[model samples]
Target: MTDVTPTPTPTPLLEVAMPALLRHARHTYGAAMRAALAARGYDDIPANGLYVIGALALGEAPLGQIIRELRVSKQAAGQLVDALVLRGYLEREVDPQDRRRLTVTLTERGQAAADTQREAREGIDGALLACMGEEKVLHAREVLAALIGIGREGE
Candidate 1:
C-alpha cells in the first residue's frame, strides 16, 4: 500500500481576523438572545434593536449615549429606537434636564425583553466558563475590555 498523508482542516476565516472573530461572537450571542426572546412571544424585536435595549437595561439613558456606546451611526440608532418604540418595547421622553435631548426608557415589555436578554447572556457566559474555565473567561473579558478602551482613547 502507498503511504498516505493526512490533510488538516482549515481554520475558519473568523479565526484569522480578530475583528471578524469578535463580530461573529457578537452575532452568535445576539442570535441566541433573539431565539430566547422569540420563544417568549417577542418575535417582533429585531436583532439590532437589542443593542439599544441592552444599553437601557440598567436604566434610562439619552439617545446620544446609546448611539455613542453602541458605536452605531446616529441614523441607524434613531431607526432602531423608533422601531422599538413602535413595537412597544421602548418609550422616548424629553429629558427634563435638557428639553432638547430625548431619553429612551424601557417599557414593561422592554424590561421583559431585557430580562430575557440577560438570561441568554448568563447562559452564554456559563457555557464559555465551562469551556474555557472561569479564569480564562474572565481574562478574555479583561482583554476585550482593554482593547475597547484602547480604541476609545483614539477618539
Candidate 2:
C-alpha cells in the first residue's frame, strides 16, 4: 500500500485580517448555528428564515409586530414570511380579533425548526459562557442590549 497523508488545509487570509474579523466572526457563528440546526433536521430554513420563525414561534402575531420586533422593513419581513409560508414552515391567517389584519404563526414544521435553532443558540451561548465565564458573558449581554437600545433610540 502506498503511504499517503492527508493534506492540511490552509488558514484563510481573512482569519487574520483585522478589518474583516467581525465579518468573519459573524459568518463563522452563522455557519456553526446552521450546522447545528441542520444536524437536528432544520436544513430547509436559512438564518433569516430561522429568525423570523423564532419570533412567530413564541405566538401568533400581527405582520406589523413581526416587522417591528425584527427591526426589518415591511417588504423584507413580508418576503421572509412569504418564503417561510411557501416552504410550509409557517401559516398566514386572518386575525380572529381583527379580520382585517393578518397574523403569522409557525406551523408544526416551523416550531420544530425554531426549537432546533433555539437549542443551537443555547449551545453556542453555553460555549461562550464557558470560554468567557458567567460574569463576562453577563457583562457582554448587557453591553449588547445597551447598544441595541441606543441604536433604536438614535433611529
Candidate 3:
C-alpha cells in the first residue's frame, strides 16, 4: 500500500537572482512613471528628482532625510536640489517655523507632475492587485518591506 504525490517543478522565476528581479521590477515602475510624466510635458525632471518630489509630496521632510533615503553623496544631493530648483519644480522659501532656515517646496508644475507620477504608479499597483489578488499582493509588500529593513539594519 503506497501513498505518493508528484514533486512540483520549480518555476523559471526561481532561477533569477534577487537583485536582477528587483532591478527589473524597479525599471517597470520607472518606465511607467517616466512615460506618464513625459506625456504630460515633464520630461525635464532630472535623474532621482522623482524620488525627491515624491518624498516631499508625502510630507515636508528635511533635505537631510531625503539625502539619507537616496543614499547619495552630499555633493550629489546639493546638485540635485539645485537642478530641481532651477527647473522650476521646486522653490526655496523661508521656513515658517524656523525663520533662519530655508525650505524647498514644490511649485505648481511640480504638483502636476507628482500627480501624474502617482497615477502611473497606482496603475501598476492596480494591475498587480488584479493579477496577484489582494492576499498575494499584501504578501509581496511584506516581503519587500523585510528586504528594505535588511538594508536599514546596516546603518
Candidate 4:
C-alpha cells in the first residue's frame, strides 16, 4: 500500500487586528509608565488604574461619562475610581449644577501619573515611528482615529 501525504492547513489571519495591536501597545506603554512611576515612589497604582487617571487628564468629568468613555461596566469603573481615590490619585465631588451627579477630578498625584503616562506614550510613539517610519505611523494613527470615531458614532 502506498502511503498518502497529509495536507497542511494554512494559518488564518486575525479576525480583528485592532484589539491585538491595542493590547500589545497598552502592555508595552503600561510597563514603561509603571517603571517610571515606581522609580518616583508611586508604585502603588496598578496599570489598569492608569486608564482612569488618563481619562481625567483633560479635566473633571462626570462618573457616568467616564464609565462610558472607559467602555467598562459600571461596577468595574466604580472599583477603579474607588481605588484611585484611596491612592490619592483622584477625588470625587458632587456636581454643583446636579447634586445627583458625581464628578471625578485628578489630584496632584494623579496629574503626575498622567504626565508619566504621556511621557511613556511619547517614547513608545517615537520608537514606533523610528521602526515603521512617519508615513506608516501617521497612516496607522488616522486609521485608529477613524475606528474610534466609528465607535463613538453610536453615542
Candidate 5:
C-alpha cells in the first residue's frame, strides 16, 4: 500500500493578506467610531446599540426586521432594543396589522444620537480619506469591488 501526500498550493495574496487587513481595518475603524461617539455624550450606549439606533433612523422597522437586517440573534437584538428603549432612544409600537407584532422606532433622542454618530463618523472618515488620498481611496474601492465580484462568482 502506498500513501499519497497532497501537494500544497501557494497561498493567494488576497487569501492570506486580506483577512488580516480586513480584521485590522474593522478594529481600527470601530475604535475610532467609538471614540467619536463617546465625545458626544453617547459613551453610555454600547456599540451594537448605536447600530440599532442607526438602523431605526432610516425608518420604522419591526423587531424581526431589525434582527434580520443586523444579522443578530433574537435575544441579542431584543436586549439591544430593550436598552435603547430604556434609555429613551427608541419606542416600541404595536403593528397595525398585527397587535402581537412589535415595531421599533427611534425617538427624538435616538434620532439625535444617530445624527451625532453620523457626524462623528463623517469626520473620522473624511480625515482618513484625506490622509489616504482620493486616488488611493478610489483604487481601494475598485479592489474591493473586484473582490466582491470574485466572491459572488461561486454564488
Candidate 6:
C-alpha cells in the first residue's frame, strides 16, 4: 500500500482579495466602535462623522488633510461640518488670528464622544496586537502603509 499525503488547501482568509479583506476588516473596527459609542451615548455621529471627530480629537489636522482622508468634496466637507455643529457636538468660532475666517472646535460633548471613539479603537488595536503578536502586527502595519502609499503615488 502507498502512503498518501494530502494536498494543502488555502485558508478562506488567504484566498480573499486584498480589497475585500480591507473592506471586511474595516467593518470589524467599525462595528466595535459603533457598539462602544452607542453604549456610551455617542450614537449621534453621522456617516463620515467619525473620521472628522476622531481627527479633531487627536490634534490639529489641516482642512486639506481632512478632505483627502475623507475623500470628500469641499462642499461635502462643509455640509458635514455644518451638520456636526447643528448636532451640538462641535462649535465654530471666529478665528482670533483671522477675523474673516471661522475655526471649528469640539464641544464638551464632542470631546466625550472622541474619548469613547479612541477607547474603542484602542481596544481593536490591542486585540489585533494580542492575536497577531508584536512582530506580525508590525509587519501588517507596514504592508497596510505600503498599500496606502500606492494610492498616494497615483494622486
TM-score (C-alpha) between model 6 and the true structure: 0.90
Candidate 2, 1-155: lDDT as tens digits:
97699877768773576447656755766777689778877777744776677767766675566678777778877777788898889898888999998767788888888887777778878888889899998997787688679878998
Looking at model 4, report the run of 10 residues with the lowest lDDT sum: 7-16
lDDT of 4 by residue, 1-155 (tens): 97789866644434447688688766888888888888887788854687777767966675577678777887877788888899999988898999998778889998998898788778888899899999999898899899889988977
Worst 10 residues of 2 by lDDT: 14-23
lDDT (C-alpha) at residue 18 in model 4: 62
Q: Model 3: which residue pairs collide?
A: none
Per residue, candidate 3 scores C-alpha lDDT tens digits across 1-155 of 77688887989877899999899999999999999999999999999999999888877787779879898999999899999999989899898999999888889988888899999999999999999899999998999999989988987
Each prediction's TM-score versus the true structure: 0.81, 0.74, 0.90, 0.75, 0.71, 0.90
The lDDT leader among the candidates is 3
State each model's CA lDDT, in order.
0.85, 0.76, 0.91, 0.80, 0.76, 0.89
Q: Candidate 4: misplaced stretches above 4 Å?
A: 1-18, 60-62, 149-155
Off by over 4 Å in 2: 1-25, 60-62, 69-72
* Sort by lDDT, top down from the best: 3, 6, 1, 4, 5, 2
lDDT of 4: 0.80
Question: Cα miss at 145, model 2 (Å)?
Answer: 1.3
lDDT of 2: 0.76
Which regions of candidate 1 deviate over 4 angstroms? Answer: 1-15, 96-101
Tens digit of per-residue lDDT, candidate 5, span 1-155: 77798877766644667778878866766676677767877677865776677767766674567678677888887787788888888888898999998767788878888888777667766887989988888898899899879977965
- Model 1 scores worst on lDDT over the 10 consecutive residues at 7-16
Residue 102, model 3: Cα distance from true site in angstroms: 1.2
Q: Per model, state how many residue pairs clash.
A: 0, 0, 0, 0, 0, 0
Model 6 spans with C-alpha error above 4 angstroms: 1-9
lDDT of 6: 0.89
Candidate 6 residue lDDT tens string, 24-136: 99999888889999998888888888888889887789555875799888899888999899998889999899999988888999889889888999999999998989999
Q: What's the distance in Å from true for residue 117, model 2?
A: 0.4
The TM-score obtained by model 4 is 0.75
